[model samples]
Target: MKWFEIALVVLTLGSGLVLLLDKLFLAKRRATKGGLLDSEEPALVDYSRAFFPVLAVVLVLRSFIAEPYKIPSSSMMPNLLIGDFILVNKFAYGIRLPITNTKVIPTGEPRRGDVVVFQFPGHPDMPGDPQRGENFIKRVIGLPGDRIGFHGDTLSINGQPLAYEVKGEYVGKGRGAEMNGATLLSEALPGRTHTVLEYLGRANPAGQGDWQVPQGQYLVMGDNRDNSDDGRFWGFLPEQNLRGKAFLIWLNCSGWFCKDGFEPSRIGSGIQ
Candidate 1:
């Protein structure tokens, strides 16, 4: 359980307890004695009763329905930029226990081409991060029992090359303008399509060779093929480590290098 989630649980439980105690010992007594006006009630007690329900609702929504995340890297490139504030649909996967993230209900499964956020399974050679379960966003490329490979820039799944239509150079804006000259390609998966950036000068590209994906795990790669540190570097992601599916970009703000701050054109944009 993350510290922040634990804190929310504690706060909710504490406030609920206070409210329950007040209802049983004070509110009921006042009700029988012709009721007490708002000003007459103990300030702390009244506040607890008023705020506990609000806190509980917020906790439930944030923990299980949807959660917001800020994009911190250009790994997703044309699809998701740095400073894009996104909303992840937690229930799209399943209902899980708060903090622990233990799945209790099976809602759905991830499909090829779906964009997802999950805990970054650290590389063995690298030191473990303080936030070991830090999240990352990437496209689902390989599923359990699937064979995935890449020859140069072309991706092959089960020995069949995934189709790509060149979309010419992508002129990046805001925080990712440095990638303005990169090649853009519309990659087609079985059920969906998304644009990907192919930065020049490959440094250990992930889709170079064939790999057999294991059971109960997934192989993911970033849209910015040459730049992301993803499944290729840290191995497959256990299904249990998934956070949620990122489905929307609610807001985009100036990050690093924007001439005029907010990217209103990108607002309310559905994440492909």
Candidate 2:
């Protein structure tokens, strides 16, 4: 579901909770009192007293503090695997209203190497779009003025190669399938570090269009380089499209080894 839809659902649930609490607690007191029991009065007052305040609190916290998201793909692979439930710092990019998603505070811009969650630019109606019904999580590889290119599977930003080192193989889990001929490597992005996959002997088109990231826009890519359909295919992410910077991996729900169990190692770990 979209973020707005989820926020609506949450608001509705909170409203319901408040009404239930009022009926169970306050209605009996009013009934025992000498006041005439107006049938509609209890429901109206209960709902009004309960819903708005709770809803407002949640809206403020989620909009300005932090919001949670689940990783649904291997596009971030070694850094963030499928089923990783993470928290995003909403105020990192700026404060935006929950349902409307309009920024109200100018906190900061997305820096290079920051892992970001963004609204997918891929056309939702396109038949072959992998981003359909999904929010994409990727690392910011290139910024507004950076010239980005890839040759022989090596990423170059502003005519300089980002640091890369070979890590071990990534064993696939459950439906966490790997590409037929892909190898995982540890990649370093300026000050941030993560992992990327390289598809050797794969005939991938090199030297994509020279993107001059327009002002208030950023270029993003998956850490799992070869497997990601990122800014390379879809257009750049506008500043308004940014949700937040992903910071923590709170849970991994892959049904690989434990169908209903949690991965202890991933819990409470920070996202790079």
Candidate 1, residues 1-272: lDDT per residue as tens digits? 36677888888888898878877887888888888886788787877778889889988998899988888888898889888999999988888888778899999999998899887767767776554677788999999999988777788888889898989998876677868888999998878888888854464644467789999999999998877887777778889988899999998985455543568889999999
Model 2 misses residue 126 by how many Å? 5.0
Q: How does each model score on TM-score?
A: 0.88, 0.78
Q: Candidate 2 versus the native: TM-score?
A: 0.78
Model 2 lDDT per residue over 90-187, tens place: 89988886655689888899888899987776753487776654667888887887777766767777777877776656666543555434677777
Q: After superposition, which runs of candidate 1 have C-alpha atoms over 4 Å from their true positions?
A: 1-3, 25-43, 200-207, 255-260
**How many clashes does each candidate structure show, in the order listed?**
0, 0
Clashes of 2: 0
Against the reference, the lDDT scores of all candidates come to: 0.84, 0.74
TM-score of 1: 0.88
